[model samples]
Target chain A: MTAENQSFQPKLSDSPLVVGNHRLSSRLIVGTGRYDTMEQMRASLEQSGSDCVTVAVRRERLYDRNGQNILDFIDLDRYTLLPNTAGCYNAKDAIRAAKLGREILRTLGNPGADWVKLEVLGDSRTLLPDPTETVVACEELVAEGFGVLCYTSDCPVTAQRLKAVGAASVMPAGSPIGSGQGLLNPNNLRIILEYLKEDDPEYPVIVDAGVGTASDVSAAFELGADGVLLNTAIAHARDPIRMSRAMQYAAMAGRDAFLAGRIPRRLYGAASSPSEGVISSRPYGTLGKGDQGNSQSGEG
Target chain B: MVEITVNGQAVNLPRPMTLEEVLKRVDVPPNYLAVEVNAEVIPREEHSSHSIGNGDELEVVTLVGGG
Candidate 1:
């Protein structure tokens, strides 16, 4: 069904996105990690037109020699920093990191941050999201008044659980993190989108990782994903700014296509047969039952 | 001889050595991150065959897993 069939057509960013009551202008989120250089990172961020960027908090006390906070590189005024528990492998660690982030924000004169990038990895090889731990953490975080942006498996069940637990948005992987695999499971992604639409039509469903190029982002948008969260694709690209712009256009195109409604696919050929006007009557090929069909055995 | 640090280890380099020569003296895994000379970050393409003189404090910030 097209969006026209629905009772309401919400704007892409109309999902009541007030993280910690801070209103965001854009639904697009970008990760501020993995760029080849700071210049490229900044350029990519500017190109993506994202209002929020994800940063990971490390337990170590290491500092760059310049005494500048690594995160300070990004202009905080322009972007809302969403500290992610990227290193956490389970619910407990991720939850603890989120709490620590809130505590750190308090000391920074910043209030408790309600927005968190909840990442609970199942395996490092594929960097797939652990549905079980993710749900556990999301439930806990949602109860704590935190708006969770859960990085989950591209599974309908996981998406349903996140939505049921009041996740601000569900972020399913396009493939694996940093794999540059690019939508390895489009079927599962479409399934998740359908599930979200049926379950909690109001909440936004975003494709988080495994996007290798602009087309990948477009593909996600085409599948009705509200937005996308990507890092490695642009960071590792030969031209980060170009890649970032490409991704931006791709997202727009995908969203536009989804809104416009894609055309249906057909199994049998349509009425326009290329050979309909041509005549060919010179074929003498046959195959026996014992043969492996070296020749056509069907009626013309 | 002037002391230069490579990945936290102090070593002696001649009065003048190109950045490239110093890299050969030290073992660093090529994976991610841009090279830095003193406080200035340098691109990877310039890393090979560049020269660094003695008494030059080079700080190479390698990018690792974050976010």
Candidate 2:
């Protein structure tokens, strides 16, 4: 007799998301902000099962000796710190922030020093990316030898432009940052994927921000997205740890579902069983909702 | 004492000192921090060798929580 079936491997987002020189098997990049406590943030990070986390560079307080640093809570050995220019509203400030972030990460001897998440906001109110400033920053960062992962609104043209400007990965926002709206326009995301991955299928396109729930992540993956980067949804949830776990599973499920492939939608019903068998005379009563006009047959 | 600008505030320093000595004024540990003097970043290894003169603007930054 053969050995008891023990060769099964659990399904997850195992296919690595290769962005620039960084490769993450988890495929979910989380942020280290908006948590009520550092302890909660640490626990959520553990539960999130993400290998990459983003942080911002800010002036280190001089006199306040409370002894609380984000690095103290994070395990630098386990997590790749992707420094972000989150609050910078212009290209010059954004570039300066990126350099500072990279220097800190480099001093820590982490590999993530090579890449930066470039976010140049147009305004503080909407928190949207300034297309002009963003492009300028991407070009400058790339020239400076930093792998730039740009965050922009869900605009296909901007996505293409970022790629054209040598961004390591183009991360388009699903909606406004922290609004919890979730992938507001998946069609735009699809078109972005098509544009960026046209000939270069392996080029990574990560959907960043405004992920309200786990379903939004699954929907993005099902729509052919390579990865998703979200912060507020998990950090600000009622139970952040559990919500982070849900997000991890959602990413895995979505990626697996995409790899497993989905069925094509048809306006007409297609029977699984043979039509000639005529099971129970087709049950011809008032058809169920959405089954109204799908009973018809023929196709070329 | 000579005055120097740090993180947008004017502070009095005992005298001209190395960038490393300038960073010692902060209460936070300098483990993962970067220093900038007059808009030029001073590499961590050179902090002890580079000098911070009077009126030099400095910025000491570290990692913070952000999305």
Candidate 3:
């Protein structure tokens, strides 16, 4: 039953996700933040099954000789480092952060030297992106030849606008950053996937934030998202390494399920067993009866 | 001597020196760092020769954890 069936290889069904000038074997992108220690961050990232890791550009802790950098714990040869413009609220400052990130990566000779996770926040409280500033930053980055992965709210029009403005990847948030809400608006995300991947199906549409658990990651992929980028979902977990493993499996299963295609949703239950070969009448006739026909089966 | 701001802290350099000299004097990690002076990025190659100036605001940045 096994020898002759070995003609099919599992690799046949595998497809890599393509971002700006990069091809990734993993659909999940995890961040190197919020872990209590560098070892935990490293372990979580190792379990996350991601080929790319995001880092923020911040002031080099001056005068503290004992300060440790995320770079010391990360392996550039194994993972591509994606630097982000996290704390910037304006296009000008975001642009500055992006440049600083690029310079740092470039100096380190990491492959992510040419790209950025562009985030231009609006209100400090909500941390929602200002669409206007984001657009401006996207154009400027594109002009400067950086592969811009733009993050914005789950607005279909904004997603489309980011794509039109030359964002390498249009990452729409499932909810507010660090909210841990799992896909608050799936319909909006569906519209975004449709709008962004209409003609260019290979265009990467990553669900960027508000992933609470492994199910959230899978839900995003099942919604036909190309990838999911998360941080606090793992970092805030009770056991980050285990959660990271769960997330990895969820990503694979969800993508496979999406590719397998789900059956249509129906209002009524459809019996898996054929009614033609029924051995006996329904025992709980009252269940389907009162709910549908209310017929009494005397043979019960 | 010239006064320059590095990472928002005012520092009085004993003498005007190249960017690398200032980085060495401050004892910051030379790897994975980017220097921005007056909002303009200074490439790595120029750091070894670029001279520090009076009242120049510098921002030295590196990669940290975030998403």
Residue pairs in clash, model 2: none
Model 3 DockQ, alpha carbons vs. true complex: 0.82
Q: Candidate 2: where is the Cα deviation over 4 Å?
A: A1-13, A60-66, A272-279, A283-300
Per-residue C-alpha lDDT of model 3 across residues A1-300, encoded as one tens digit per residue: 587688755653768889999999999999988888888999999999899999998884632244776788899999999999998999999999999889888888899999999999998887889999999999999999999999999999988889998999999999899989889999999999998888998999999999999999989999999999999999999999999999999999899889888878867755544455558877756455324432333333
TM-score of predicted structure 2, chain A: 0.88
All DockQ scores: 0.08, 0.78, 0.82
Candidate 1 off by > 4 Å:
A1-23, A65-67, A107-112, A266-300, B1-65
Model 1 RMSD vs true structure = 14.3
Candidate 3 — which pairs collide?
A289-A294
Candidate 1, residues A1-300: lDDT per residue as tens digits? 776778676665434334435555555677877776666788888998778778775532234443334554677567777768887899987886676555444334433256788999888877888888999999998898787888987888878888888888888988888888889888998888887878556557878988889899888888878778888898889888998888878877777787789857854433333433447643565433343422433334
Q: Across all candidates, what is each one's fraction of true contacts kept?
A: 0.18, 0.81, 0.95
Error of 3 at A282 (Å): 3.7
Residue A24 of model 1 has an lDDT of: 56
Worst 10 residues of 2 chain A by lDDT: A291-300
